[model samples]
Target: MLKQKAGTRSPDLTVVEMRRALAQRIKLLAEKPGEHPTAIPGLSLYHRTTPTPCFRASYEPGLSIFVQGRKRILLGGTEYLCDDSSFLLSSIDVPAQSQILEASEKTPLLSIFLRLDLPTVREVLSRDDIPESPPSTHRQGLVAGETTVGLIGAVMRMLELLDTPEDIPFLGALAHREILYRILRTPQAERLRAIATSGDLGQRTARAISWLRENYAKPLHMEDLASTARMGVSTLHHQFRALTAMSPLQYQKQLRLQTARQRMLMDGLDATTAAYEVGYESVSQFSREYSRFFGLPPIRDVKALKNSNTALVSVA
Candidate 1:
């Protein structure tokens, strides 16, 4: 159960009640254990009936609200523990490992994930009425915070819109704006704002990350990447590590490996073929790295994943 503060407030509902309502709605929509995309674009609901093993996945820029159960995310050496009251904000694309820690058939893990619309975030930031918070010294891409009643209410309304199909095209945009506005009002908004603001180092580093993600199969050149972000090589390296919790080369390797795993599982590609397809020149080197990262060789890992009934949940 979600632990409530002594005097948490809401206009017509307590925080815990609001969370329960949201969870019930999500449970109704997501009847099975997997990601369920809704009519609203960029919004997805997740349900897991049992605790899962740690799985490597990539998280894009988004806001994830947990209404039930608990999860843990590992970014580099840092571990973030999230429960019913927690919200995770990802300011950029990142690779990480995640596991569902507290879940059961009676009380399954439930969450609402909304992919951040950069244009809407920028629009919300442009408003003069939004309260200003202190700038964050360390601009990490993924941060977790406690959820508030107001934020939960906005998310609940977003889910409520699914019942009315015609209202989505018009009200959905407004809902998106309001959700972003609520997030910007929080102290955690600084990292998000820095990334959305033009010419900011955070945004520049984000551009470099985007480039790396798009061209993961290609050979990486530090000078070219630095030039793409319009920053000096050393500065780009500093800011890139500051935001992603890993060096650029490490990030690229993760992308390459994850994509290769997906292809081998989903496309039936052999280990040698998958390695070469994902820019690995030597199959032996790819197999060694894959084993080290995934704790199993390519064939064994893919076979295990294929036999398992659980799907990898990527929203963190």
Candidate 2:
């Protein structure tokens, strides 16, 4: 929840109106109670009828705007809550746990997700007219901010494309760029600027993260990761933790565990085989860590997950 001080101003009424309008539009488009793709590339719409139990997933860089109800996302120990008044943005790919906190049959959770185009972000930064924001290691890659009329308007136009699919090829890209421009003008601009700028801490950390993602099944070396990121080991450790909220090894562990779970659930691999495929040397060690991370051993967890018939609407 947003804090309200004695003299603090209340939210603007225009934002409330925009939120309602977006919610109504989504309700019309998303007749089913789950995530659905729109005509525009990299855009997804979501609707949910009830509060949900927490579920874990990896989210790539994107902006999630909730229109009707509230949702909470947990990244490491950080909590990001989004509702009609606010939006959440992830500037880098990050593993997170999320839950729907407020929704009902009459007023379900409605949301739109716009995947960030890093190339376009870099192109926007390259324009000489745009002001340069100084880079900082303290910048967090995941954040939530109050919605603006301009941002909401851009999203509204993007969603409007669903009504006229013929104009999507020519107009959708322009509308997406406009949305990125609006976000680049916000206070979080520097955080994103750092991610796209070459040689910056954000870029360096991003490279390291990419490497870990691709080679998660292989044994990791701290020095090798630092070298790949073009930073000293100490600097890499500090900046990586500041951006991602975890050490390099911890990040790899999460990737491995998540992948192993996916293999078992999706491919029907046995627990021991899945563990080995994900680089676990010992089955006992794999079971212990898996249990610690997922709250159950592999077999039992997979069974429970398969038995549950609930459908979760999420954005990545």
Candidate 3:
């Protein structure tokens, strides 16, 4: 028999305690006055304040878990939202935008992001020791699922590495692997299952998705690209849209615009030049498209980014 809460269905008490513990650990991490640490070696830690709105962007394949706030992401046209009780995963390189919907200064948003390694994910799927269920639901690139005690325990174990940096190099990898294993066994495992195999239609579409991610500015020969993935043009057109909620061309366009924005913000590329480098033949067309996607013209957006950095420097 299971114990029921005052207003909710019965679940294991151990599961409830584990989920609460994960949230507590995350809260403590957020209180630390520095950049949030990441599981990935290359990427810097990231934490933020204020409610942000979704803007066209590229989100690398990763796990995004929140403890105190809620966020909604727009992947192509499909929307996925998660809060304290839920978390999200993306198994493929994806173009999307995300915004924090709930946050405050006192108890600001606390999030943990883990990089996704396709090779590792594939290895896990191929292992005979672990079992993954057959997928039946329509697949989307992003998925949100209810948090579980096993998953929360894995997350807590991951954070426990912060104090023992020496152990992290070896132990962290194991813990991270455990977290992925937990996800693979979760109810939403179907999404990851789809991305894990090369034989499935969804997996084939992901192959083409990865291509656009690395070569966003390259001129696309749709038929040739489809051939590269061993998919026909018509089949690619249909399944790709079903998985990502956008056509290949539309995905590339968003990728180009987001890249141009990043170049301007980080590399000081001027609007027109950045536009040209992103495969835009007409400066006017580029400007119009950029403005439409970002809600600001290139010059204004870049200027605002500079000003924000300046303010941060002034405070520090």
Candidate 4:
């Protein structure tokens, strides 16, 4: 049997070896930009040679693990930091920024992100000795836990598939499955596991979230959304906030404003048109909400995005 770790007993026998191998994998993947789709899709990984000061921005739901550095995330006015021994898990969609606290010119900030997918989590979770974590109120935008060796090992194997295209369609799936499985068995795997199997208020809230993203610009009705989530309107309202740290309407508003901002920046759409396209009945309302969420009016924000060159760029 694999020796149990000091604080946590990870079931995988090769946890330590796996972490060392994963260190190498992160180094290799960091060699080039866009080299890690097998691990994280839709993110443009950046290498930082300098330690960054505190900052905050919206963090999408995902796993962010650094191989050579440490960082901190600021959310709801709280700061959380993690190093090589730790990994960050963002369960729900959040708008927060993170700062790199540790980096070196020689080592830089080496990291890899695996964008979490709900459907994928569901599939892998159905297969193992996974246990349900007791539900909690007031979900966190982010949490940190000691990185398990098995999790690291699974990540390394997933990256290895990049060198061989033939292994992807078949072996790649298993690698992906194993990665999730390892996460299920980790110390704080409960948060992610909750994401996969909870049929409670949180899960219902997540379903309502899917509706918001899929139809951001549509006219939103609480009753309709509740029905879609298979919950009553009052229950939906309470549960959505309990899970996402924001109200349902607020959630929809964020989705609309972000997409509208993107349209203006990328497609060069005029502010009025962008507002209408993203489902604002009145341009005035769009401008008001856009400024509230993004800290700038549509035209100025678009200009800023263009000037920055890195502003609101798409994963593509």
Top of the candidates by TM-score:
1
Q: Write down the RMSD of candidate 4 (Cα, Å).
A: 5.7
Cα miss at 311, model 3 (Å)?
A: 14
Question: How does candidate 4 fare on TM-score?
Answer: 0.79
Lowest-sum lDDT 10-residue window in model 2: 1-10
Worst 10 residues of 1 by lDDT: 1-10
Best by lDDT: 1
How close is every model to the real structure, measured as TM-score? Answer: 0.94, 0.93, 0.86, 0.79
Q: After superposition, how far is residue 124 of candidate 2 from its true place, in Å?
A: 0.9
What are the per-residue Cα lDDT tens digits for candidate 2 across 178-282?
887887777667777888887787899999999999999999999999999999999999988888889999999999998998888888999999999999999
Q: List the residue pairs that clash in candidate 1.
A: none
Instruction: Please tell me which model should have the higher lDDT, number 1 or number 4.
Output: 1
Compared with the true structure, model 3 gives a TM-score of 0.86
Q: Rank the candidates by lDDT, best first.
A: 1, 2, 3, 4
Error of 4 at 251 (Å): 1.0
lDDT of each: 0.87, 0.82, 0.71, 0.67
Point out where model 2 deviates above 4 Å. 1-9, 133-138, 310-313
Instruction: For residues 89-108, write the lDDT of model 1, one tens digit per residue.
Output: 89999898889999999999
What is the per-residue lDDT of model 3 for residues 207-287, given as tens digits with 9 covering 90 to 100? 898888788788999988898778899999998887777889988998788788888888889988999999999889999
- Report RMSD for candidate 1: 3.4
